[model samples]
Target chain A: MQRSLAARVAARTAALRLTNEKLYNEILERRKAERALRATERKYRGFFENSIEGAYQSTAEGQYLNVNPALARLYGYATTAEMMAAVGNIARDVYADPEMRLRFQEMIERDGKVRNLEYQVRQRTGEILWISESARVVRNRSGKIVCYEGTIRDITARKRAEDEAARLRQQMLQLQKMDAIGTLASGIAHDFNNILGGIMGYVELAQDDLPPGSGAESHLKEVWKAIHRAKQLVRQILAFSREAAPERRKVRLAMLVSEATRLLRATIPATVAIEEEILTETDEIIADPAQIHQVLVNLGTNASHAMSGRAGRLLLRLEHAAIGGKKPALKLSVRDTGHGIPPDILQRIFEPFFTTKGVHEGTGLGLSVVHGIVKSHGGEIRVESTPGAGTTFMIFLPLALEAPQ
Target chain B: MAHILVIEDDEHMRGSLAQTLERLGHRVTTAVDGKVGVASAAVAPPDLVITDLIMPEKEGLETIMELRQHQPSIRIIAMSGGGRLSNEDYLHLAKRFGAQFTLAKPFTRDELKAVLAQALAS
Candidate 1:
């Protein structure tokens, strides 16, 4: 009996010792696995901190799990801790437009990864910056989305440079348009000047041959009058051809208006009434006399045509005013009681070849030429009108103190 | 009356020139091309010839050269609108090829009469 009992005790002690050894081995294996996980995390942290681009990890719900110092600086925060405290949800706090975060989520869900997503992100100070991000979904072992990891780079300066280059290209196109118009004018002027020379020469010869009191002399006088009218037409052509220079002279605005009105009265139908209001007696301006005359004539003719088949009043008013506190200027306003310009067409009225008149009646260069002349003389012209009311053109020219002899 | 021959390609300008010269009491003959002009000048030897520079079949420079060879002292007047040639080049070629004088296109009646009178006197 004693020997049997002793064998039992020995068996039990051996079983206990085996169990302890197995437990110790299991603990050691678990400790080794923990150390390996810590090393991997340390290596990842080091890489994230040292990288130039911003590194971040966010939950699918947009909660930040980890962010590098580079990310905090990129977002205009002083430290990662500060950014984490303020920016609780990246989708809500950092993205200026919340739709951007949703778009990123959609991209990743569709493609398993989102590449180079560019958007404007709001900083801590409410300022916005452009950021480019490339990110991938972080998944658990079962392929379920847990978080997202991404790199961000600032691209604001590059975007600004592209916009500036586009603006300069548009400006160059406008200059090219002006250059082409100048070339066309030079060619047309050379041909037209020759024709005018022939006409003028023959008129002078016809005048010398006709007797003073005969019927032929009266007929010759009428022909001479027509030739004089044709010469004025030639001058207008020369203006566009670049052959004629602007004849600048210091003249009173009142006298210019009177002379223009007197000439226009003969051409406009007797039904249309013409009136003038000279507010300033000494309002003087330096301008090309011939060009100014042409401007007045063109405006008057346009007004007459606008009031065709209707009784209307055309008013030519001259006044003196100060602009921008610099100098006093003479203001000439041509107002007509006729159909007003539409809103859509007012913007393009000064463009070349844009006219409402029927074919063969208007060349469409009248307003464009007027605009060019006004711009060349350092003056300003503006049109004011309503849909139902008539239109008024007010031209402001710097006043000249010296008077013509 | 002085007999004058005119050669021009454009119908309107040619007709205007012929009428103006006829009104001035000069006998005028019109030709539409340089070859016809040269042939007319050769057969009749008109008192004066005014021909345009650019034309079909026979150009103005060649016509002037051939006309001078046929009638050495025929008194030719060259006219052009300076279309393809510069003013200086046109004058140079005309004088070089034995033309008495040259006038630009769209010439006035007075200028035509004066140049014709000068060419006839010379």
Candidate 2:
């Protein structure tokens, strides 16, 4: 009986050892599988962290569930946590146009995916950024949408470059139009000059045949003067069309002021008269004769408009001034007895596009262009006025040391 | 005084111009266009041919060139009341085509006379 009992106990011990070894191998296999799974998860996490393209996962209700660092940076946030806190609803708060996100969602829902969808989004800083997104709807086994997954790429720089190219093309077209107008203007000016030539030549021929101081000769002189004024108008139009650079030369201001006033007299109502106080003898400045003539004409026109057809005196003065009795400068002043400028707007008179005149009356560029021309020639201009009395514009220009070449 | 040929398209202008030249004591012949003017000049070969630059047939530029080919020593005066080109531009071209003198239209009689004197003297 003792020997049988000992043999059964030995068999039981061997079976227990065999079961323990199998349990140990099974535990080792499970640990190896767990370690392999953890390595795969880490590889994907690294991809999410280092990717340049923005990646995000959002709930069906538009709440951000997961966002990579790139996505946070693109939204103008310091961190993903900050982006999530700042943006509560993606469709309402993120999209520049909320409808765009709705359309994107509808497309993803219908097709299971959307590729290269373009939209504008407002960054956290309140600036709009152009972006293109490729996204897919994440659904559960029941085919119900649980969330959305997508990548966003900023296309703001590309859009800006395209806009700049379009602007350049428009500018080129404007320049071409100007060139065509210039060609047409040349032809018109030639024809007008020919007509004037006929009138001037006949008047001179009739004068040559007339006796000295005859009444007819004096009458012919008046007709010739009118034609001279007409010629000046034509020249001004030609200069504008050609955009010719002012022909800079030593020019006397007195001659230009009187000529401009004489031309103004024929156009303005007789109630308005012109006065001149030009005393500068041979005081010459380097200038384009036509441009100086234009400056006077513009100021005279402005003065006339201010008067508004009422009787008034337009005083034009040209003089030589010495600052502190040392440095010499040429001074010109245009004074108008009219409804003067109000104090509030006097400062903005020289600002470009600031005009009180109606659209058909003026472009408001007159004063600004005058200011630019004076500044380019090293000059200063100022205005003085009393609301009820009158207004005067004073212009000072440095004398050319030697005539500009 | 020399024999002058006036080629003008406008009748009124031609009449006035012809009268003025006659008063200055010069013998003058008139033609309506460059074609008639060339034929008239070839028949008589006047001392000086005053041709208009822009004409309906055989325009002034071509007229001047053709006249120079026929008579290399011909004294020619070209005048124009500008067309598509500027009067100065037309005048410059005329000078290039062997015109001795160029007058812009509606020029003073004294101016025309002065150009004629200079052309005849040279």
Candidate 3:
């Protein structure tokens, strides 16, 4: 009996030891699993906090639930908390065009995610930025969208670079076109002038042969007048095409402006009022006086035509301008109270042979000649027009350093 | 009346110039180009010469230089329809090359007469 009792005690002790070892091993395994889980969470959190790109989470109501530090600075905010507080309505406050938000939502709903969606967005400072976003919708068990998460990258620099390149290409094309036209105009001028000379010589001889007050003489006189008009047109073309350096002289710009204004008053309809204001203290510039006179006359003529025969006022003003740190320049502005240039035609106004006038009214070389003369003189010309109101042309010419000659 | 030589390449221009000079009470001789004009001038030595600048055989600048060297006292008038440069620019060059006066083609009768009178008076 004693031996049987001892064996039962030993077996019970072994069974208890075995149960304790199994329990301890289970506890150790659970602890290892908890540690690994904590490490994985920490790794993901580090990625989220330290990412260079902007990361964001927003609820379905366009309320930002969370935003990383990079996103705050991109939207011109001090901190992520400040950004979230200021941007309550993401569509209205953030998207440049609120409709873009709707489009984003629709696309994401259709495709479950969107990649590299580019758009313009408004910052807290009211400045604009181009941003590219990649986003996905977070859904619940029932497949209902609960929130949205995205990464955003600033793309404004790239957008500006692309725009600048396109503008440069356009400018190059325009210059090439002008060069070709100049070549063509000069080529034909020689033959055309010769032919015109021959015709004029014959007509004059015929007129001299006819008796005084004869009908034939009058008809030939009319033909001579027509030829004179043609001659003037050719001269304008030559002026535009000529690459010869101008005869520059140091002259007071005020004198030329006054002379051009006087001519303008005499030529344009008397009904259209002429207002002149010469406000510059120093008006001397080294330029070809004839070309400068032509510039003023052309600008004045263009202004008069803009009125289309309606009663209006043409204002010519010469003022002093201090342009940055460079040399002081004289500003000559020709303003008209008439129908303004439309936006579509404004960019092309300086191109040769571009005109809105009838065939008999204009040769379409006025502004182009003005442009050429200004460029040759190291000056700049700019135009500002409002569709219904009027137009103003501003010319900036560098003032001569020497005293009046 | 002054003796004049008119040199031009265009037939009508040459004819018309001769007629105008004759009407102005001057004896006129005509040539097709600068080469013919120089040969004619060397043969008879006219009192005055009106030459076109752009001609086939010889250009006006060279012809002006040759004639100026041949007879320093002879009066010369340069005319041009203009080529690559403007008529004014070419005419300015002609003046530099010893031509006494210059005319752009398609000039009026009055303009031609004025230059003619000026050249003769000086």
For each candidate, the alpha-carbon lDDT, in order, equals 0.75, 0.78, 0.84
Measured with DockQ on alpha carbons, how good is candidate 3?
0.29
RMSD of 3: 16.2
> For this target, which candidate reaches the highest lDDT against the unseen true structure?
3
* lDDT score for candidate 2 against the true structure: 0.78
Off by over 4 Å in 3: A1-33, A138-146, A168-192, A208-215, A236-399, A402-405, B1-15, B18-87, B93-100, B116-122
Candidate 2 chain A, poorest ten consecutive residues by summed lDDT: A167-176
Cα deviation of A104, candidate 3, in Å: 2.3
User: Which pairs of residues collide in candidate 1?
Assistant: none
Pull out the clashing pairs in model 2.
Answer: none
Which candidate number maximizes DockQ? 3
lDDT-based ranking, best first?
A: 3, 2, 1
Per-residue lDDT of candidate 2, residues B19-79 (tens digit): 7788788999999999998999899998999887766677676688788888899999998
TM per candidate: 0.42, 0.48, 0.58
lDDT (Cα, tens digit) per residue for candidate 2, span A251-346: 777887887776676555668789899877756777776656666776887888888767899999989986445667788999999899999889
Candidate with top TM-score is 3
**Comparing to the true complex, what docking class would candidate 2 get?**
incorrect
TM-score of chain A of 3: 0.57
Residue-wise C-alpha lDDT for candidate 1, range A97-181, written one tens digit per residue: 9998888889987888978888999988999988899999988899999889999999889877666555544543543354356
TM-score of 1: 0.42
Q: What DockQ does each prediction reach against the true complex?
A: 0.07, 0.09, 0.29
